[model samples]
Target: MSTPPGAAGKGRSLSAVSRDRIEQHLKFLVGVRHPVAAPAALQRACSYLEDTLRALGYAVDLHGFFDGGQEYHNVVATRLGTRRPEKRVLVLAHFDTVAGSPGADDNASGVALLLELATMFKEWRPELTLQFVGVNLEENSDRDGHGTGLRGSRALAAFALQQGWEIEAVVVLESVAFAGGSVRQAAPAGVPLQVPPNGDFLAVIGNELAQGVVARFALAADSFDIALPVVPLVVPDNGELLPDTRRSDHAPFWDAGYPAIMLTDTTNFRNPHYHEPSDTLETLNLAFAVRVCQATAAFLLGMAGGEGAAPS
Candidate 1:
């Protein structure tokens, strides 16, 4: 496999076989129909995530809760750091795809990245607690915004609050698959984004309160030659007010006042297959996805060190 342009020395390039393996995994996850209310499919996806994490030697748990007369469980896996366990970093992604769509880039890509990172970190211990969460209900029936559209993340945040968990930062990975645009387009509202319009970059967006973390992530992105646009916005009070910004799992973390950022390829805006039946695995840029994963892994490693190094 060819080394991604900006990731020559930081880490080894994923082998062709490894890349193929990730692609196959993405195909399997996206191929499944994981609707929010579909208990069977959700169970299957959750089990798959759990098994993957367990195979990597991480202790996994399921947060099962009742919603809409059905049982939904979110998968949480932890990789205990060798250093300070009190400091925690949460990496989140929703596994529940939209109803009727394959959701290849919408979510399977994100899950694939998470699993790949987990594989990389299996041997190298981190300094802070790293939690990989596969959330549920990112896409649900409540279009009116009354219900917890982000049930899994919201529940996790509430649990953290109750437990008094000291989260250093939270990173939400979503739609890190498709990237083919230029760098001059206007970012979605609520965040000031300056990315190549070509879509071949990662965007880290958070509330104004998380600006420091976002800046650090951006700095770390530079070491890997990953193009990351950091956007720190002033999130509004009414959730319904910021439709574009409030569209993903990261919003819940921001609502809770935690330093959080959404790492994405700008879903729906640049992805032609967003939320459509045609959103298949073929539409994803596998090379770019691998690059994104590598960059993200590096950023997480840097953050665990507490340096919050800016991208060179």
Candidate 2:
């Protein structure tokens, strides 16, 4: 996991991602977006994501799949690379929310960051193709009879595998907003992992295959002066022993043998409003999300090729 040159510097592209833009995205997306429970809201969210990506000059594609004779969609916006278009990197987040909760921090934060990255790199041609994917039905664990969640991501992973796409990395964002100086943080009970006392940090979890990605994110997180710390955890065997680490879209890419990692805020471990009705936009820390966005931009730019590009 060699660090990209100048990896410990603030992303030059950070100027393109702003706190206001993130809030705008969250304001419209932070709601109960379920396929069955709130289909209209779900569709509206999907349309908004598509339109936003399209406005950013991305050729958005609604990748569709079916489960039990029902159809679902994954919004994919591709940014073709100039140096190596064959190899690709994925920046993805799920948009669907769990029933009864608005899921502001649970996922709207992640989706907001995804859109921000899309805008940041809209005109910058990287070395590796970047795909910003907004997936659906990530939180449908049992409410909709969807067995285990991540159906959208699992389907996309399978589609990528079937197409034989050369995936360089998959960066999944999951609940990346909430952070506080005094907020309590804890790992699952009996996991033996030492968590920070405060939640003012980001967690980068990956499998052995994604150690390099996790290391890059940790370095990027520290590169900026945003009071945000990064905790990098590389689990063995795709986090099979620690199920909490597999609770996002990255898990599907890991299962498909692609190097993948998740950027998160340790959702249920630190956020009391997680999966509750109180998880609204007002409770989110936009500053925290901006920091995450900056670090992620640096990380992705470093991975793509370099930081020197014409302003998008």
Candidate 3:
């Protein structure tokens, strides 16, 4: 990948230390058993995220609720913006993994990226208030047996609407660690590929409402020397779908009538170990993860106007 003009000699790239942190986070997730019926492991993961946010100077809030007599909580950390409060930008990633899989690439990768970004934003706030949300129940619900319903994101969106919160753009980081053969932007079943095969690049999948947002994010990604495939398209209603677009935590945001996009490594379509017991930390492309995080930080900083702005 070509290096951006200004990013030639910036601070250290996400380091070995950071990669180690990501691995540790994945290890923690794999060590836990977060079933759909009872989510004790999910709660523990939330606690870990909460502590990390607190250490980064964010006042974390737990939106706790009950469903089927089981407690579900979404961890939210807010950093006030220096310029715009009414207009906010949301950075979301679901913390809860699948029922049985270790989910290293399925979602722990996304959560690690979120935590890393939280650390970066704590030092440099954005012009738009930034809300980092770690959602629960992205997996199939015991009752509905549907993963696309997105119980946690739906609840959060409803609550935000009720509270009159203006969400300008929502960016959902889904899977970021695994990398394999060329990456392709997979649309729903019968839909054409939005972009080319280039697994080294990030794919921004969204609808027409978020087309401009996806463009801007792609520009920012390019500015950071990140070659991301920005695919702005509508999802088809077909039941059979490409693996990349079919599985992720971003679908909820789009379903809620908000402008949202998912950043992923194409999941099962590209990763051989996806959703399998062998999906361990050793299989992750740490270099790709570091580059992805760097690109994400650059995009946020550019959107916020500079590194001096407080993280929103």
* Clashes (N, CA, C under 3 Å) per candidate: 14, 0, 9
What is the C-alpha lDDT profile of model 2 across 1-312, one tens digit per residue?
Answer: 233344455543355668898999999998898877788998898899999999999989999988657787899999887778898989999999988899999899999999998887787767778899999888857444757988899999999999999998899999999999989988875454677898998988999999988987777656654456888889998888888889889998999999999999999899999999999999998988988888888778677763344222
Candidate 1 residue-wise lDDT, 213-241, digit = tens: 77767766566555434433445442456
Residues 1-312 of candidate 3 have per-residue lDDT tens digits of: 122234333342323226666667677765333555346776788889888888889879998765566677889999877677677778888876655567777688888888878876676646677788888776655445643546677788777777888777788887788764554334334556545555565666666666767776776656545443444444443112544464555565565667777787767656777667777777888778776777676666655442353322
lDDT of each: 0.71, 0.85, 0.67
TM-score of each: 0.84, 0.93, 0.83
Give me the candidate number with maximum lDDT: 2
TM-score preference between candidates 1 and 2, better one: 2
Clashing pairs in 2: none
Runs in model 3 deviating more than 4 A are: 1-17, 36-38, 143-149, 181-188, 194-198, 227-247, 306-312
Clashing pairs in 3: 125-309, 125-310, 125-311, 126-310, 126-311, 129-312, 130-312, 183-198, 183-199
Which should have the higher lDDT, number 1 or number 2?
2
* Cα RMSDs, all models: 5.4, 2.5, 4.8
Error of 1 at 280 (Å): 0.4
Looking at model 3, report the run of 10 residues with the lowest lDDT sum. Answer: 1-10
Please give the lDDT score at residue 211 for candidate 3.
70
lDDT of 1 at 215: 78
